[model samples]
Target: MLIYANRDAVEAWSREEAPDNVDVLIRRASAMVGVATRMARYEVTPAGLPADDDQADAMRDAVCAQVTVWDKAGIDPTAVETEGRVSKTSMDGASFEYDRAAELSERTRVASTLCEESYDLLRLAGLIGGRPWQR
Candidate 1:
């Protein structure tokens, strides 16, 4: 599947390399696109509709937000494991620690959430009707 948001757009929004794992990111973004479109009360075209500028930006930001999620994990989010030590381990008697993923930045969290809300991002970005959202 073709990603609506290009690498440049993702880089501009994220300032990081787009994931080399294109298929995984594309799959995630595709699902979100449906959710976003639905929240906008818009039906997706059977052949796929081109996004307007604001919608494209939102899509770019949203995809980069997901890439950030993987980046924070210090492992390819889409990779499969064959064999490895567990992320958590116990010592001698009872001491143990677990690795924790980094927290997502506020901007990424908000951008992803906005896209998920569909109507919010679409309306706020004026990709939908060029009018303020009804209270």
Candidate 2:
């Protein structure tokens, strides 16, 4: 249910077509989890109860996996600066200065931890459905 727009195509489309594709993409990504849950046999109760643990876990895992893939594909998770002062020519640009490198490393570690946690969470969720959890 993940929709990745071609960056080049999006830019071209923005010029010729409407700019609403951005919003549409956002809406689709946001709704993917709910759609996935329903397809997975989860029914939301009227009491505002959270989704079944297993389903939630699965969703988290899927999200984490998606992030992991993007990370491995060289997308910087800490590139927040908009100023042109910092160079973006290489992967080892100023963005990875000593302090930034350490922070990025720590963040990567944390992301990996979260990925594992999501898997464990999914396992727990499966238990709620009286199904054996598989890793």
Candidate 3:
């Protein structure tokens, strides 16, 4: 239940007033971030946010970006319905087919819940993967 983004933070990141379900969005987004960054260990604040200011802000922005994408997609994050990119298309029949979600379980999570902006935010924050160099 670690919520990385609040109403005010989400609103500021999105540059728009948050919706009534902002808490719900934050919960879902935070869960997605946890899953996405399970490999990276970060020092957290007393409130459970990243200790590094930049990383913490990036996390908030990433969560907010995810919320914005979910809000735009109109998909209920709490629901079990499958929604995402089209998997199949037919040129002749003019048919389109969407991919059904793979089996879902608490531990069998997927990255489809994350949006592009969120991914980029985490990447830039050095949370997803670090940039190593030698001088």
Candidate 4:
């Protein structure tokens, strides 16, 4: 699937230099946007972007906003995972501490991830939860 926002747009969105993992971040953000916007209905170009200029811009902005939010949270969606380990274990000594960071990444790991700002932008553009939502 095509990424809704480009590297330059992501930088411009946050007014900061993107991290080295930016390319993967963009792809991940786009996937999430695709799922979120699946319920949206809009005219599309041959490239699969919204036909209207404003709607297209909104899509791009929403993707960029998702990237910005994920970056700020220090969650790298492209990170490789290791074998699953016991999240909670107890013996003579009780250990309640678990991998909280991993939990945060879990939310970002899926294509369903959607930031609040991104949702708002898509909703405002009528690209979500409106009309017939025809792909």
Best by TM-score: 4
lDDT of each: 0.50, 0.38, 0.74, 0.77
Going through the candidates in order, what is the number of backbone clashes in each? 0, 3, 0, 0
Worst 10 residues of 2 by lDDT: 126-135
Between candidates 1 and 4, the one scoring higher on lDDT is: 4
Writing each residue's lDDT as its tens digit, candidate 4 over 1-135 gives 978888899999999998788889889888877887776678889988889998889889988998887788777766634334447878888767576666554653533457768878888887786422332
Best by lDDT: 4
Please identify model 3 stretches exceeding 4 Å from their true place: 83-112, 130-135
Candidate 2 shows a clash count of 3
Instruction: Quote the positional error of residue 132 for candidate 3 in Å.
Output: 20
TM-score-superior candidate, 2 or 3: 3
Q: What lDDT is obtained when candidate 3 is compared to the true structure?
A: 0.74
The Cα error of candidate 1 at residue 81, in Å, is 10
Model 1, position 68, has a per-residue lDDT of 56
lDDT of 3 by residue, 18-86 (tens): 888889889888998877777777898887778999988888898999888766656557764444434
TM-score versus the correct structure, for each prediction: 0.49, 0.29, 0.69, 0.73
Sort the candidates on TM-score, descending order.
Answer: 4, 3, 1, 2
